[model samples]
Target: MDETTIQLLCPECTKDWQASPDDLPTPADMFHCPNCHASRRTSEFMRTDRDLQTLKQLG
Candidate 1:
């Protein structure tokens, strides 16, 4: 799959952050920062895999 970049904002702190495609979890999967215990939906932060596939084809 093609790599995509993503920027995410913390819902609780409004913290701005960025993560590459490799950093994301699977859909509906929980993400917790070991240091902050920050959690979020994988889909909330990255583009859908199907959408990425479409982008790859378009390009």
Candidate 2:
């Protein structure tokens, strides 16, 4: 099966990347930017509300 991916944008650094939902924490968990290392709730990094919903459903 094709792996599920989610678009992520670092709210602090604006670094954009794609990651598999299975590799990430829940939407409410803390996330650190792989670029600047700035930390925030995982949902804050979602590129859009749709991305957030995808993460909520699949992350």
Candidate 3:
């Protein structure tokens, strides 16, 4: 089976990671980086436009 995940980045700390779309909050919601605790809009953390779209569709 294939799995879909959202690629995330922390602009404040430059941390990167992946997470299931279902596990994340809405794209407009505040999201904190697990590594730096830097908080920002979830959409800002998305690695690409596609990633942001996926989150909007499945998050």
45: Cα error in model 3, Å: 0.4
| Of 1 and 2, the candidate ranking higher by TM-score | 2
Q: Is candidate 2 or candidate 3 better by lDDT?
A: 3
| Candidates by lDDT, descending order | 3, 2, 1
Give each model's whole-structure lDDT: 0.53, 0.89, 0.92
Q: Candidate 3 residues 1-59, lDDT tens each?
A: 88999999899999999999988999989989999999999999999999999998887
Could you give candidate 2's per-residue lDDT for residues 1-59 as a string of tens digits? 98878999997788999998888899989989989999999999999898888888987
lDDT of 2 at 34: 88
For model 1, give the RMSD to the true fold: 6.0
Runs of candidate 1 with Cα error greater than 4 angstroms are 1-3, 33-35, 45-59
Per-model TM against the reference: 0.53, 0.90, 0.95
Predicted structure 2, TM vs. truth: 0.90
TM-score winner among the candidates? 3
State in Å the error of residue 42, model 1: 2.5
